[model samples]
Target: MGEMYTTHEEEKLIDIVLDSILSGVVIIDNKDHVIVDVNETAAKMIGLAKEDIIGNVCHKYICPAEIGQCPVFHPWQNIDRSECVLLNYKGESIPILKTVKKIKKDDHLYLIESFIDISKIKETKEELLVKEKAIDSSINAIALADLEGNLTYVNHSFLELWGYGDEKEVLGKPSVEFWQDESKAEEVKNALFFEGSWVGELLARKKDDTDFLVNLSANMASNEFGKPVCMMASFVDITDIKKANLLIKRKLEIEETVASISSMFISPKNIDQTINVALEKICELCGCSRSYIFRFSNDGTRMSNTHEYCPEGVSPQKGNLQDLPVEMFPWWMGKLHNGEAIHIKDVSSLTEEASAEKEILEMQGIRSLIVLPLYTNSELTGYLGLDNVLNTGEWEEEDINILSLASQITGAGLERRNAEDMLMNAKIAAEDANLAKTEFIANMNHELRTPLNSIIGFSDVLSSENFGTLNDTQKKYLSNVVVNGQHLLRIINDLLDLSKIEAGKMELFPEKFVILDAINGIKATMMPLAKKKDIDLKCNINIGNPLIVADALKFKQILYNLVSNAIKFTDQGGSVTIGVNTSNELISVFVEDTGLGIAQNDQGKLFNPFSQVDSSNSREYDGTGLGLALVKNYVEMHGGKVWVESEVGKGSKFTFTIPVENQITRA
Candidate 1:
């Protein structure tokens, strides 16, 4: 135990060797736990010089052991090594892994203690535990397996996800056995080996042998030599997600079918084609073998497959069924008559109520069928039928509801077809009537104008005294006859012209002429009548472009009709003016009369043939009620428009505009 036994130089040599090592070392007597020898590493570790610690008790510096409780001094206690702290000069704690063991050297037993800093190791160990806990609590299934596919480790979620009660059930077993598809497992293994990872969806098997869809990702784990030794995998169950996607796809198909059928009914050019397309879409969407629309007869005693569709190599009922008698299927007829649709899943399982109908259906190779009643105006009109000859199918409520909508669309289409037919027939009848009226007017104009002109000619001849000298009374009477005949001829001509316009046979011979000249001619002829009525007649022409290209004769007739009507409506001393506002763009003519204005309600009737403004005024004014109608037609034929503005007792202004584009008409 005496340190002076060794030379100073030898002790220094031993100290250098001890301090050169990374771990602190010290020696003590096993009997008393006394420090007999210490190395430079130990001196630096405990903050002491060799001389001070050479004889001190070991427990005072590094060991917090009780009397004779040192692990090395009392090896029989079985405490070989333990963690402890050492006090430095600054009274700070130094962490050390202190181990003591009895060693016999030079026939004397001593305890050698060894330790090093381990703070980083403790921190890293805690962090690793935290990560393990995180992996175990994850929602995703996580597992590790050996290269040979033996399950090495699994998390709690992995156990719960694969229908396993405990990890012991799957550990060390082939992971491929957990896959529903073995080929997919091979694929995953190959991907992990070649690409360092594998990611995809695959069908996986549970412990109960039930299959589920899973989104799986697996990565390779390697040893220190960089050789792949195991695999780490994470999975999420997606079985329900796959089912929902299928449902969404089916819903889209049904919606597309409904849209196509609705479009067909809205614009049905060919009824057969529309019905066929509708049937094809419905059949395709519902996975039916055939489809048809059976319309009920008027008496409800029979029905017929008016429209039918079938796949290739299938028999068509349209060619064979003609007015199928309702008595043939008694039970079916009763249901249809009550407005109830019929759906049969299996003809072989029909009850007593469907025996007769099922017998007929099976005779035609029908296994399953569905019928939806079609209605129009709250009355059952027909039915939409679907047949599945190959497979006995059960129709879902959602599918039945879609077919019902198809039935309604069929009803609307048929109803619209009937309406269109009626409209066409009515249109044809009206055209025939209009043609007859036009011909009648043409013949009457010829027949009435001949004798009327002869009467006028004779009256004028007699009044002229060409045949003989006449008395004053005879002269006055002849003048009256001529004036009345002229009036009647004018009325006949207006009727003929209006008929021509309405019949679309009226023609205009356009010519360039000063409209004022035509107005002058009319005014000269009408002034005598206006003077007789004590009314003033004037023509105001603002002829900026007097070289107007129009039907000059018709234009004069239009102005004459308006002016004459005004003069007739005006009282004595009232004024009648025919004027125009001309421009490069258009020529507008106004016939304004200071006289009794037409009523607001009666103005609508003013331009209708044979429609007078007022019954009371009709008795006072001489008119056939065709003047304004002819005026409107004539003005319109020249690409012009006419409108009237007036107030009660404030007179009226009838204005008409002729676009300059119409001036393109040449003589």
Candidate 2:
């Protein structure tokens, strides 16, 4: 029981030393080298319990006892430092650094063994070395220079950038010598020295004395004493980017010039004037010697230059190029007709196919040219040409596209003018034809009604016994004459109504009327016909005591036409209904019928004068097909609209809406 615990003071001292430092500590007896005391850190580091390690022989667990020597040993040998591995509870080797010192406590000899886990530090050091190698191999030119501007260090990338064969070539060279701009070079150097940093684009000279652009960033490095030691810089080559920026600027300018010219064509009062302006702008923006627009003759045998521009030194080819034979340049004309441009970078490159055109172009000192064909209504009408007389260069695809767009814009202007002229002529002709129709209808109404009225009146008198008493056979024939005469009169009236409405001459005479009274009157008049056909005619007046504003005669005519048409088309034993639905804003009327339903496609033309839904039913149904047309015209005259909803083999509902206030009333 006494051996199980150390003295209380010794235990307290052990805890004080163990908790004071981060490293694991263990004390071993001198003779047996067994762990007599262990701290929490030592037990955790070895992955074991403190109780298990305190009584264990140090060499048996971790001191590589079977191999060579123990780290915990007597002071006479003085073994202070060594590194080894300790096996954890799981049998995994954990790397550690070991140091030993002999201590005399309570006049007893013991070995103090202390160590630190160095596994993570070892791994971190290895990763740092790898990253340093990656930095050295980077593509960016990396260099370090002393404060005196002599190169101290440079990677392969830096050596390669300066066209140096080896590091010795640039070891002591002043970095400022590589910068071409003397003033800017001094400015950057001053900034690096005084401000501790500088970054910008500056001109740099190569070993061959050729200049380039570089994006360089430099920083001043310092020692712990706060004195400047050296400078480090990273350089990126940007020579190609500078050149590309200039090219893009030129292209944008050309596009802007072409766009401005296209906008002027929208109100082109004179084609030649607008084209001349375009030629001037195109020649100036494109850096060309001459620009021209040529129009083909109506006979298609020749072309004449209608507009042209020249930049001072170029000869004027506009007048001399007029009326040239089109066949002489067959290849050129062929390209134009196919909507393809003729881009000749050099006239000398033309072969025998273009010999004729080449001779003409060379006579005007034109070495390079681009021609775009212009068409009005898809017919080749003209061509736009740009010529380079002094300088010859390949026309870039972008330049050619801009010129082609210009030609298309010109063609649109021509087409628009032609269309406007045609429309004006059409309007005049339509007005004259309408006037003639108006005169004919007026004369026919007088000439037709005189004879038709006499026939109808005479038939009526004969049937009424006013002239003489007629036999049953004669009366029957006379009744047919009167019925057909009335039908003929109805057709004539409908024609007149349609003509008046189309001519915008229809007038509405509005009057307030009792809607219910009108509905009852229509029902009474239509009852005999419905009874003969055995149809169930019905009326649903949802509006209570409603007084509607509309022309009395026209309103009655609309109701009569709708009811009559519905009755005529409906088969026997079917239903015909008149529904008057009123709202605060308007009056909606529906004439629905469960009849031989109209087809969906045919319903569109129902209100077109003389249009029948089914041509085959023309003989079966006796009508001029003008009733619905007149109904639509009258409804519209009172500021209303009409439409139909129907499905084949089902039913139909014809609806019309009239604003409650039909027209301005006259006192």
Candidate 3:
């Protein structure tokens, strides 16, 4: 009995171990209807206890319907095979994995069934559905392709982005069909096979056959064995980004052009060069066809073309300010004269008068232009005109500002050039004046020395008694020769002194002396000439003798020249008078002569070198015309003024005044 208990115990243990296995197991009796044995897994799968399943028919516990309605219960009924379904339990169908087969034990028919719980697989499929829904709702287009480059799946975004309705229309198609350029297909395939991923831009065709650019990132998916199974690609539309990038690039180019132009003015060498460079730079920067610089005449009657830049065969019409035909340019001149810049974006939209100007410009292929006025010291000087920008777009405020600055620089350069020209002209004039004075000195030396040489030679022969023993008449003629020779020598000396004064080389020899002494010295020297002409040369002193500091030699030379000219120009019987007067700080000398008075028209030329009243008067005077001119210069050197009061037929009075100094005067 113990041995029998041991066998039963071993069987019970084996049954418990079998019941613990994962697969559902059951056994049926030979009748093939009732369950004789069932493991725990099988009993739980049918929602029944092991004892209940052991006695019940397997069809009642495990079939999809009740035992009376089950088709598997009748063996000859030709039931096809086992199928999976939820078993009926407690009036509800519980899902189970079922399999049924016939087992023959000792020549009796028995049934064995096996199954597995497959509910997790159904839950996993539901989860996969959720993931697909999520991908379809994304904004970015998502696509899936098989390893062979065939389209396998595509979300709604992918279909809509490519202008397709559903995945069915796209699934079997090769991904290369969406690429606008067929050559890119090989590159895409290589990227997927070698690198396993590619991210770049590409042109894609839509359903309407129009192409657009897209930024695409494609990645390959592979199984654990490293064989590529599929590929996923995500793309974003980049057409707008591409357009914006183009615009930014153009703007940067414009800025670079403007910067280059601005650097040209850092240190300009000259006005014309600066203007020319500016014109070229502006044309290049704005993409213009022509440029010109116009300068107006001072009288505002004409405009001169200073510079022009254009294509080889193009030429601008020359215009005059006054005759610009109000019908052609009504406001242009007005604005330019007012120092205003004018900008015309579209010439066609201008007024009638402006339109006429525009028509002329358009004939030259100019559609847009900017005119900047050049001003200096608040006066309009010229204009800087740019024409025919290729784009015909409106100029910005910054462009206008840059042009305004260029105009200012141009105005400054022109002003500097004009001033330099004026200085150069002044230097030329000064050089010419010096040359004229040099010629005058040479001519005067030859004229004065020739007559003086003859007089001295004749006088020396007579004095030495070389001619013969002199009679009374001979002695008188010799005396006359000596007197005239001395007079000629004095005139030559005066001429030399006057030349020195004019050339800024004369020096003054100053000393203290009485004014009466100077007058008496002059009267004593001129008495002989006056007596020969029977002219009364007198000295009148109006002030008490006053001592003053002055150059005695220059003073006496001045008095001698004045007195001698008076006596020489007076007629034989005319009287000559010398008067001296003194006041608070000046001494005045007056020499009056009854002579041929100067004409009013000849007064202005009186002080010029070698000039007489006129050429006719030069022949009548036996005196050098330089005496009076010398006197005037010497008097001015002493800080005095010499002038004449005369009428055509009346006598003349030459008056001169010198400043008096109480201290010692230097030589």
Runs in model 1 deviating more than 4 A are 1-127, 327-330, 351-355, 472-477, 538-547, 599-611, 615-625, 661-667
Which tens-of-lDDT digit does each residue in 1-667 have in candidate 1?
5332357888678677877878878877876768887877778877889888878777777757656656754567544446677766666777677777776756677777877766677788899999999998999999999887789999999999899998999999988999988987988887888999988999999888999999998999988999998899999998889899999988888887898889889978997789889998888888788899888899888888888889886788686677988788878877877888798998889998878777777777889989988886668877889999998868878768888898888888888888888998999999898878877877887788998999999899888897789999999999999989998999998888888777677888887788778878999999999999898898888777777888888888998899988998899899999888888878999999999998899888888999887667448676889999998888887878999998889999999988754643321
Error of 2 at 89 (Å): 24
Q: Scored by CA lDDT, what does every candidate get?
A: 0.84, 0.83, 0.75
User: Top model by TM-score, which number?
Assistant: 1
Worst 10 residues of 2 by lDDT: 66-75
Q: Model 2, range 282-401, lDDT digits (tens) per residue?
A: 888777888888989988899999889998877788879888889998999999989889899999789998899889888888889999998989999989988998877798786687
TM-scores of the models, in the order given: 0.82, 0.66, 0.42
lDDT of 3: 0.75
User: Model 3, 249-282: lDDT tens per residue?
Assistant: 8678656655655565554566577778777766
Cα RMSDs, all models: 5.2, 9.0, 21.3
For residue 199, model 2's alpha carbon misses the true position, in angstroms, by 2.9
* TM-score of candidate 3 versus the correct structure, residues matched by position: 0.42
lDDT for 355 in candidate 2 is 91
